[model samples]
Target: MVIFGGAGDLARRKLFPALYSLHRNQLIDQRFSVLGVGRSERSADEYREIVRDSINRYARVDVEDEEEWSSFVEKFDFVSLDVKTPAGYQRLREAVEERERRYTIPGNRLFYLAVAPELFGPVAARLKEGGLTESDGWKRLLIEKPFGRDYPSAEDLQAQIAGSFKEEEIYRIDHYLGKEMVQNIEVIRFANTLFENMWNNRYISNVQITASETVGVEDRASYYDRAGALRDMVQNHILQILMMVAMEPPSRLKPEAIHDEKVKVLRSLRRWRGDDVKRYMVRGQYTGGYLQEKEVPAYRDEENVPADSDNETFVAGKLYIDNFRWSGVPFYIRTGKRMEEKATEVVIQFKDVPKNLYFNKTNDLGPNLLVIKINPEEGLSLQINAKKPGTDNEVVPIVMDFCNNCQEESPEAYESLIHDALEGDRTFFTRWDEVSLAWKFVDPIRQAWDQEGADTLTFYEAGSNGPKEADALLIQDGFRWHSPYNPRTGSVVHGSPIGD
Candidate 1:
């Protein structure tokens, strides 16, 4: 494994920790080695110590065995390589070759780009020029997100990477798809007879997917300001989850077959332009307010953010998939930083029964709902109506819950993603066409925001459930956002039930 940004935060906080856990579990082979490329000058022993500290600090599992730690560190090698010039690439090549020969292992190489997006093309070109991809064994390139800001930029990056590697050789990582519950979307829909039969417009009324964060962007202000909520969250994570919920079941569970189904969802999205952008999308920036009983600064007041910046920290939109399965159903997506609670969930609100036989007119029983909890917890629950105990012909909301948080610990998303990439399982990774189509669907909205909707930046208090206009986006359609503000309560709080 060759990591381009070996000393960066992601390498220390996530990448190295996941690798250490993999090694601790004996999943990584003894013949496998890692060559870290960066501009820092450090001895192999020094780099090993850095990795040791990182593992101790961030690894989910214990790395306390002295002999095991020593064995793991022996595989670590570092080379100082300035990506700007070709000379450093030659040195990197030598380091990899030496490790391959010393370990007596076949030259199966996995090059991971954990650096900024701007350097993706330059590094790939240099790797090719230095003969890194000409190995006798299989070679794969694993790239991190920010896969271009929009459609054109993504295509340009794709062309540049395609110059050195084939489509099969590339793996674009979206760690959310690696979550256990997200992977279960296929199982819940396909494996279960009850859900598979009703997973369409007929039985489903609206689907709401929410990924809200309680913490503000502290160090990531610069990047977040430019990317905003739409490009940062909607274009990748939210849309990927949407596909998992809306896609047709694949003929077989192969990578290509899954990709085909997901791509179809993207292509089926109703294109929004002109007034549709304003009508269907709501953008907002956070203002200074309380979060978790403590006050926090607004988005504009954060470091590196312009005082008058209209960059959106929150996005809520209604997407309609113009297909037979989901023709009139709306897929509502909402994401933000510095919101009420840290949660990632999907709510499938089934249509209500026509006849209210058990409840009075004023106390109308709600529709049945299926909630898939993804983060801060992992589980599924179904909402049903039941007779109120000791009451005469009264129906009340009741829940059937499956709590995934009962376990002590679950594997991090990065762990699964890295493992799949090593084993050549592309089921959870996004393909080129999927990325392109997502960008195509997202570009017009972004362009409209830049041109006319910039002033549409409404302000919501920190730690709140976004601006009220988000509620209106759904209220107009006779629906509402499903708020899991307190997942521990096991209650699905609709937007109307919670007032400011």
Candidate 2:
């Protein structure tokens, strides 16, 4: 493995930890080795110390065995290089070759570009120029998100990289796709007779996908101010989750079949224009408030952010997949930073019964819901109406919840993705067609925001859910966001009664 930004935050926090976990689990053989490339000056031994520290800090398992720890770190080598220059590529190539020879490893290489988005194409081009892309074994390129600012820039980046790597050799990483619940979406739909029969507009009412965070832009103001919530979250992570939830079942469970089905979902997304943009989308910024009982700064007050910046910290919108299966069903999505708690979940609401036989007994019966919890907690919960134990005909909402992560810790997102890259499984990775169509679907909202300036941008308290307009977006359709069940309190937050 060749990591471009060896000393960067991502390498320290995610990549190294994931690699260490793979080693601890015996998933990779002794022939596995890593060549760290960066501009910072460091010897191989010094770089090993850095990896040791990161593993100890962020790895899932502890370093209990001294011999195993030493053996794993010994496989890492570091080389100083300014990747933008051709001369640096020569040094990188030499380092990679020396490590492969010393370890008696094969020529397979996984090039991980953890640097800035602008460097993605240039680094690949340099690798090809230096004869590093050719090998006796296989080669792959793994890229991070924010693929481009919009459709045009993304297309240009794709063109530049296409000169060196083919579409199949490129792995576009959307970490959300690596989550356990996200992968289970396909199984829950195709493997179950109950869900597969009603997974359409006829029996389903609406779908809600949410990814909220309580942390503001701590150190990424420069990037967040420019990318905002739309490009940062909606264009990649949220949209990818939407695809998994709404895609048609593939003919087979292979990568190509899955990718084709996902692409169809993106192609069917409703395109928003002129007046539709304002009517369907709501954007907001956060103001100072208390989170977890501690005071926090507003988005504008954050470091490196302009006082009057119009960039959206929160966005809520409605989308539709204009296919026969989901013609009238609305897919509502919202994501933001510094608001409420951290969670990423999908809510599938089933339609109410045609006639209410027990309406006179109790009108509190809630709509049946299938909630898929993704982050911080991994579980599935189904809400249904049931008779109270002691009452004659009293009806109330009851939950059948199953917690998947309560027994043992699951693999991190990076761990699963890195293993797949090594084994050449593109099942979870996004293809070029998916990325291009995602950008095309989101470009209009971005352009509309640019033209309107900050006039349409609203504000919400940092610790609150979001702007009131966000709720109105759903309420106007006679629907509401179903808050997830809170395990700590044994209740749901802001839960509305059925038929509200």
Error of 1 at 82 (Å): 0.3
Per-candidate Cα RMSD to the true structure, in Å, reads 2.0, 1.3
lDDT of 2 by residue, 114-224 (tens): 999999999989999999998898889999987989999999999999999999899999999888889889998899999999999999989999999999999999999
**Best by lDDT, which number?**
2
Candidate 1, residues 1-500, lDDT tens digits: the string is: 99999878989999899998888877778898988888989999899988988988999987778998888889998999898799988888888899999998688999999899999988888889999998889899999998999999999999999999899889999989989899989999999999999999999989999999998888998898889999999999999999999999898989999999999999999989878998999999999999878989988898889998899999999999999999999899999989998989999988867553446354356668898989988888888878989988677777788877665677888899999989999999999999999999889999989997557788899989999999898887877777643447655544422211
Give the per-residue Cα lDDT of candidate 1 at 213: 93
Please state the error at residue 253 of candidate 1 in Å: 1.3
**Each prediction's TM-score versus the true structure:** 0.97, 0.98
Note the Cα lDDT for every prediction shown: 0.88, 0.90
Clashes of each: 0, 0
Cα error, candidate 1, residue 202 (Å): 0.7
